[model samples]
Target: MAATPALEIAPEKVAHVIIKAREYGAKVGAWNASTEEGDADEDPSAILEDFASDPTLGEIAGFIDALNDDEQANLVALAWIGRGTFEPEEFDEAVDTARSEQGNSTASYLLGLPLLSDYLEEGLEKLGFSANDVESDVL
Candidate 1:
């Protein structure tokens, strides 16, 4: 099934976020596995230190912040659907709840989820939006 155009947040935008989240997860995994003795060419501590100052988290935060309140709420609702807290048919209710409970910082709230990428992807699928094209383009 095709994605409903009624969706407030575009599928393309969601795809972008998913890609960034995946990239961030990869960087985190690499940072976790790195060691001083691992690779001579790459400094583990330096890499980890660089990550601390990197704009990855900030970029995501900024992207999310740029969205309108309704868009942000929809994003959160989709994520909740993906996370299994709400079903696809309950999308409206999810969005309503997200809007009602929305805090000041949507970015902080979203970035805190470790499995954000997976959840977003799942949510998109449930919404009848396939991320395959977006994923390929990202690669």
Candidate 2:
């Protein structure tokens, strides 16, 4: 394995983002018309419903938006690495690209990715950080 490069973004911060991203991704569209008749009190699965008012989305976006420019760029680079757009050894290049290509809000860009949680987790692992360990600590 290659030596893991140091990260401008902290692993714990990434872990928190991963946890929130998973929560947001796990949400399903609102109950179908047929299932809408089901009693909400009895349907434990209601928690999975993606209501427009769900706070998870906003929380994650806000969190990402709060990161410094370098951290945000590194976060995007990490995702690119995990998504196989770049190898772990190409970390610097990925970061450079992320920095250069950033047009919209980092939060918006990252939140748009359907596999954000998985990518971040894989990125952390590729960088030789234990996602589980960091997540455990955060939890």
Best by TM-score: 2
Best by lDDT: 2
RMSD of 1: 4.3
Q: Which lDDT tens digits does candidate 1 get at residues 1-139?
A: 3334357988778888998887676664344435422342565444433244567778888999999998999899989999999988888889999999986698889888999999989988888777787676656
In Å, residue 111's CA in model 1 sits off its true spot by 0.5
What is the lDDT for 76 in model 1? 92
TM-score of 1: 0.80
Candidate 2 lDDT, 68-121, residue by residue in tens: 999999999999988999999999999999999999999999999999999999
Show the lowest summed lDDT stretch of 10 residues, model 2: 31-40
Residue-pair clashes per prediction, in order, are: 0, 0
lDDT of 2 at 98: 100
Candidate 1 regions with alpha-carbon error over 4 angstroms: 1-5, 29-50, 137-139
List the candidates' TM-scores in order. 0.80, 0.91
Q: Where is model 2 more than 4 Å wrong at Cα? A: 1-3, 32-40
Tell me which residue pairs clash in candidate 2.
none
